[model samples]
Target chain A: MNTEIQEASDILKVIESANKLKGAEEPSGVLRGAQNAWDLLSDEQSQKHITTGSGDLNSILGGGIHCKEVTEIGGVPGVGKTQLGIQLAINVQIPVEYGGLGGKAVYIDTEGSFMVERVYQIAEGCISDIMEYFPYRHDKASSGREHLQPERFLADIYYFRVCSYTEQIAVINYLEKFLGEHKDVRIIIIDSVTFHFRQDFDDLALRTRVLSGLSLKLMKLSKTYNVALSLSWIWRYRCSNKLEVFVWLFFNDRLNTKDMQERRNIFVGDDRFCVLCNISASEDHDHLFWPCPFRRSCWSSIGIQLGSHSDLNTLISGVKDTASAGLFSEKLL
Target chain B: MRPPAPKPPLATSTYNQQEPRPEKPLLLLASSRAAKLSLGCPLLDRFLSGGLPAASVTEIAGESAAGKTQLCLQLALLAPLSPLSSSSLFLYSDLPFPLRRLRLLAPKSRPDLLDHVLVAAVHSPSDLLSLLSRAQHHLAHPSRSPNRLPIRLILLDSIASLFRSDFDASPADLKRRSGLFFKISAKLKELAYRHQCVVVVTNQVVDVVEGNTGNTVAWSSGRQVSPALGLAWANCVNTRLFLTREVDGNGGSVKRHMKVVFAPHLPERTCEFVIRRTGVFGVEPAQRSNNSSEVKAHGYYLESDRTRKGGSNQHKQCTHTSI
Candidate 1:
């Protein structure tokens, strides 16, 4: 009993000391002061937004890029992820006379994909939009003419070209002080946060820790500094939408003999027969859904045609275009 | 061989009147204002909140060619010029001391600047231990009476070299190393506090391998590089600063970053600077500094405009998508 009690007391002492050290050394929590829900709501309301240069995207994003929040804009290659980042960086410098947040930007480029010519074009586009909107406010426009220049816009966006993951982390860790000194900066856009982390990293656990720490630091920065953070990165989802769920459910049913054939193919590699058509075609999700003769009629009978089964996103968009007209109208009615 | 009798306080006061008596509380308070040793750069001084504080162990940890030695050289060069008017002692290990580079950083006006900085080559951690322990006696009570300034700035460039191969990665060896670290730091701190001197040590960085899930962001060269000696020596230092370098691909200009990892007084802050022939200079945003008046005017206008339209605030409603 005495030995057990001594061990327990020693453990308790260790736990107490650990807690004390944690409380003393945890620097993340001490930077920002406490705020109630009302303060947050008020701060949120009064926050200025950076226009995305596209009215639709701006409208969809609840008044463009939000300050004090991290908005991830992700898409495949050639979908203009870099373009939107550049657009936001340029549009952030839009004059306060217009309905925009007249603040600077810090652009962290990991992939060396940032084009200055594209940024100049976007700046020109923003200036034209501002001129078109407030043509009558001649005095204000004249006074802010220098600020509206593409050169000035390009100059305001502080660009840090980081080569590797360590440089990326260093730049991000350095941003708190950078933002503190440059108070005019209201947005931080990391063009690609995952480019360096995705490749050349052998230890999976260390990569996850570093990436999570980077992301948490970013989130805290956006909140503490009240700066908008836009991170563009590729996300791989195992299951994304209802279509994927339907596919999952179709395979999940053990009672369904049709899916059983596809499942049985896993064990019996030679028997590659389509369950629905009884044809000697290799069975897969795409073949069973659209291309197979037995299911093609059924899909046409339901008045749905699949276009471009190259990718899931295109497939979803195709379905949305054909089926969503009636569904949206019915909901509206 | 008897110990000298303790001198009477009144007699010592008259004897030490040539220099300010350091024992008085009033004089100590006056000296506290001049406690920091400036690094010779206004921008760095500002970034460090009036340079390195006296009576503290400051560790400047960095990878190779991160300008750690350059910074220490500048600090040593400028130590005698500070308000305290004290000299610096630089103990180097591993590589030979860069005397040529030191001379390049030395200004043309101060021809005898090197004389103020005392340099010594320490072969091992044991050598450093004995040196510092011996210096503690000299620091507490200086034998030399007058004319010469006290050594208030003590710098050991690359403390990692001394113990890199001395200890193996075993529990027992690590425990011994940790004890030595504590002993060295305790003596250094004692010397600093008793003599009101500054202690600065440069530490090399090693690649972070695994299980380092700490809040500290010590990174370099596409991998996380942590300060050598691990957590044992980390506890000994009063302040820790990390220096990182990046080579801009196209321009090829090397940008060096210095950040405070942890400090009693300073917040975690970083600044970018470049090393030039003269000294290390901070890379200020050129346009911002040049067009300061215009930017200020623009900001003033915006502020007034904001206050004028403060009463009529509006919010645009948009579709909210749950992430």
Candidate 2:
């Protein structure tokens, strides 16, 4: 825990070839250096969230996202994360009169991806929803004073297009003051947070530290301001990892097999190997176990009565039905 | 005077060019109009505490087409008004410099000041290193123009472009690439301090690690991708500014805000401005300068929503002019 002891230990690790720290000693007392964990808890704590209007997302997130916490959404390209972002920005503008948080939004588009036309469409949908529920009491509202134009809700939201990570970090750090001045503003969204950091990172450790500092600022702003901070990160297919790989793994197998003559490929059918036999074949889901020679041998070797069935589901039930006491008995294993 | 005072310490001096050189740099008097670089944008000048400070590197970072080069063009046009001669160095590192925009922003009178500006394209980090030398050599011996014009400002529009595209930094080569950038920064700092000219470097941004940076590091605060070029280059910077753009209405007119991210003398404040045909101009938030029907120039900074409640002082003399 002591400063000198920590440095000594770090150097010892580096000397022993257990760790690799680039700089001998990191320059201490940089901007917003490491703080006591208790310092953050000293501030007021509240778990309030403005409804995003979409019931499914709100429910999935346990009664909408926490305004006091930062939510980072990452996905492959063309995932419609920006669409969801724009919808949330528009949805956050529901006035207090209509069972909604009367709050404004700030959308920071780093990659020039924020579309005004899309925001307009979403804003119009929100206005119609508001009008349907909280219908104007005055019959001659049009002639009277009340006017609901699409621009009204759109005006409350502010958008910032940032090119560099410095600007991205700057706008985020300065957002505290912006939020304070514009008290009504309650949401901040950045489309594709990793757009700039993908290419040139001259110093990895330094970039991590700087990124760590900026990340701290975003969370601090969200908590202090009690506003939702949502940012989306996009990755291409070639560099797919994390969520992309997770999704791809489950969805990679195809259900239907198309015509082999039309498609320009050497393998006739699916060109997949059955896990049972470990041999290549024109494989689909049904052929993986049943109907195939490898699967027939696997079924016969186990002494489970194999029968003719139209599909895999019926075949599964056929085995289950015939194996009454046999299910309880141990197999060849 | 005083034989140019021995070129004090690579850019740390606030000597205000008083040590003297070939061309007598303007006296950095508080009252003199030439003391500050105008930047042609009044709100920017006011926010910047009388424009960019001399003998320091000011980074104007933003996204592509965030009016960085536009601001650079404005600075080049107003370079003549700086403490020294009208000349400047515009190094296009990413893409070709927009000559049409430069010509448009150039002052009709003293069009030759445009000629005083030297333009060069940087291919790589090594290329940039050589270009820096060529700039110094050219400044030392004038051959292009009739009269010697000491460059008072150096604009490297998006300095990260070439570095990002060319260099690939693995753990083995990280030291080499960073050392190269450090050398470049040292030279730039020397250029800035010795000549007492402004060095405005533009850098592109990147995304913070999504699930990566947060869990590994000590982020009780949160996570974000730090700006590009890392701390190696960040250590040498004097002032860092960020430009963020946002559209006001369906009309698609963007409102740009300039934030002083880090600087010894400047506060971290963001001021809103609009880009017009002439150049970038500051706009009052209440007025929404781009939109006139909702707001009139006559109105003050009163909330539009409060107009229905308060009848008193419905009309007042405008204290500020926007755009």
Best lDDT among the predictions, by candidate number? 1
lDDT of each: 0.66, 0.57
- How would you encode candidate 2's per-residue C-alpha lDDT over B142-166 as one tens digit per residue? 6665574777788897778867875
DockQ for the candidates, in order: 0.01, 0.01
Q: Would you give the TM-score of chain B in model 2?
A: 0.72
State TM-scores per candidate. Answer: 0.42, 0.39
Instruction: Assess the local accuracy of residue A114 in candidate 2 as a C-alpha lDDT between 0 and 100.
Output: 47
lDDT of 1 by residue, B26-85 (tens): 223235445778777766776675678886679999999998899899988988888868
TM-score of chain B of 1: 0.79
lDDT of 1: 0.66
Query: Could you tell me how far off, in angstroms, the CA of residue B250 lies in candidate 2 after the best superposition?
Result: 4.7
Cα lDDT tens digits, model 1, A1-333, are 999999999999998687666565543442335456776798788887887766687789887889878888875433356666877887788777776778888888654445453355456666766777787884655777767777778778787755444446657766776677788888999977876554333344435545766787788988776443321111112222222222322322321232344454534345556656867776655566657899878766666776758764466556757676545223212
Measured with C-alpha atoms, the lDDT of residue B11 in candidate 2 is 22
Per candidate, native contacts kept equal 0.00, 0.00
